[model samples]
Target: MLQRAFNKYIDNFRGFSREIWILTLITFINRAGTMVLPFLSKYLREDLDFSYNQVKWILISFGLGSIVGSWLGGKLSDKIGFYKIMIFSLMTSGIAFFGLQFVTSFEGLLVAMFFIMVVADMFRPAMFVSLGAYAKPENRTRALTLVRLAINLGFAAGPALGGLLIMTVGYKGLFWVDGATCILAILIFWIKVKEKKKSKYTDKEHPGEILTNSVFKDRPFWIFLGATLITGILFFQLFTTIPLYHKEQFNLSELQTGLLLTLNGVLIFFLEMPIVSYIERHKINKLKVITLGCLAMAISMYLLLVNQWAGILIIMMLFMTFGEMFVFPFSNSFAISRAPKGHEGRYMAIFTMSYSTAHILSAEAGMDMIRLFSYQNNWFFMGTLGIIGVLLFIWTMKLVKYEPPRNI
Candidate 1:
């Protein structure tokens, strides 16, 4: 009887699992390659024999490619089919990763990054669409959290592992690992995944451009976009100026710096669901929750500007993380619920682009702040931007006529 009960439990678990596990595994492999990302700027300058201007151009080209790919990916998914588009894009991304092995010059690197990012970005938008499609609305947040959990686990391991590989096997060997994993992800997904076709609800949206094209004309999306632009300005500063602050101001070792970031990811991974539960139970409104999260992120980044030891910074990060947990998942869930039915792909694409655009523009501005005044000014500038974001979210609540956001 106990054995029979165990078999029944196993069957029930499988029934509930869905294909999310496969998707998570694929996403894990992709993000794991990101371990090499932190060191890339240095490599571009030192090993590739590129001028500073050339390296800047390469990064710009990569961002531009993602912009292009995001738009195209949404379009293709709308027209062709999400699964087919995803599979092909994932395979191409694996090829692009392999291409990294040969690139030796600025021009070669630019071309390689262009293709790599284009394919990678394509997969992300498709993944968003897939998540939106497959998960029941009530379970969506939990489902997406699992995806984040898997990716973070990969991200957590990637940097430490990449650092090891770079020292022992050299940089090229790390690139090999990146390529091989992408291929492995593709193979695993191709054999195991099953996709649900969108019914007539999708058919109406297609040639969806007629409806989607004019979607910009609506003032609500514009207001949300404005709010998002400011929010992006605040959160995106971490990638650009935060590391320099650690090194120049705090004098942290490279490993210490990497672990700080890993901690942020780890906090987000372990605490998100509990944090989500806490935020939901709080009597505060959704807008308030989002504002608080943005504030926490902004303040923490600002704290780095101050003279502090490692312990202080880590503590501030923990405080900021509490807010981040509430903001990202809840904000995304609220936004998708507000989207016009069947337009999830387009809505998410625009939102994701906010982050991409912020990263590119902030890099130069962030470096300039550190150069002219100090790295502290980088946080000062971004924190002010975040304050403005908080007000914009408040104003959006007053201005937009949509139904109130359902959850905190």
Candidate 2:
């Protein structure tokens, strides 16, 4: 029975095409090279000697660029194609990283950060559209989870490696390595991942047929997007406010912070795929899964209310990691499944916007909130946001129905 269960677990990873795996590999390579954003807050504060407000504004600029990039990527993916966009984003963003190494002044850093993020973020919607194009409906969630698995696995490596690199090569060296990895991922994607011509969505009409329906017209999706943005604002603190909290409240070093943050990726790397597979095979209600995930997130923040110790932080991260494992991949699959045929890029882009927008708000608002209020208050606010996220998902679930995979 144990062997059988193990085999079943292995089977979850089977059935995806070589292209899908290549796409997953591309995500992994890119994510593994993601050494910048996680450390940007710290770099701004300590290395660049910026104030709290300056750091917030710099990050906000990056967020604004992300918002633009997400929109443009989706629009351009539909018009041009995902492959071209992916290649361009990878190569140009790599160049941008190299360019960022030269910037010295605050204004220069902000401008460079904004452009780099803009180019880098263009990958999101295109990647989602390609995943939908490549995978069967029944395997969609697992496939998405597999990609996230690769991302988390890379994330597990990126920060820990980044911490080490900080001591060895400093921030500029980090950018150099990051740029090289993006270039490498681009090569793999260009050579290995082929474009597909088959219909990915349920519309029987031609690709041009559904182009008339804009994502703005999709009321249910907007409702879903709103909910996503709410959770996003709270969830993104993993990068911004949380790190600052560790620095100020706990007085932990960069290496220590990276390790603690790495705990999140470690949990996701080990558990996300199996759990998502189990939930998918068992035909569990996605709504229930999401609701539970949000509640878990809420509880994690509330747990932070009591202590500032490493033990409590780890416990809080455990709950948060579980919540992330449950929510993110399933949500991506949900967006893919709901996309209106040709409008997949737009639909997915709008969903991507939630995070991009959250990136905007989380830095500016979250930092300000922590400054004016306190870390304890921020935790309370995040907990409240999570509860609101739960209510939103419960409500949105009623408005939207999951369309099963169409065998093209």
Compute the lDDT for candidate 2: 0.80
Off by over 4 Å in 2: 1-8, 42-52, 198-214, 246-259, 308-311, 401-408
Cα shift from native, residue 35, model 2 (Å): 2.0
Residue 84, candidate 1: Cα error in Å is 1.6
Give each prediction's root-mean-square deviation over alpha carbons.
4.6, 3.2
lDDT by residue (1-408, candidate 1, tens digit) is 999956753432232255777888888987787655766776788777688899889889888878767767766766666687788887887777667868887787888888788777877667877877777665566566667777778878887788898889877777778877877887887789787686456547354554455357645556666767666665556567766677877788878877877788888866776555444445446667777877776677667665766677787667566656756676666555555555666666666676677777678777888789876677788777777777777776665536455431
lDDT tens digits by residue: candidate 2, 263-351: 88777776788898789778888867877887888888898887547678788888888888878887787676666666777777778
TM-score of each: 0.87, 0.89
The prediction achieving the highest TM-score against the true structure is 2
The true-versus-predicted C-alpha distance at residue 31 of model 2, in Å, is 1.4
Name model 1 segments beyond 4 Å from true. 1-16, 203-210, 278-285, 308-311, 400-408
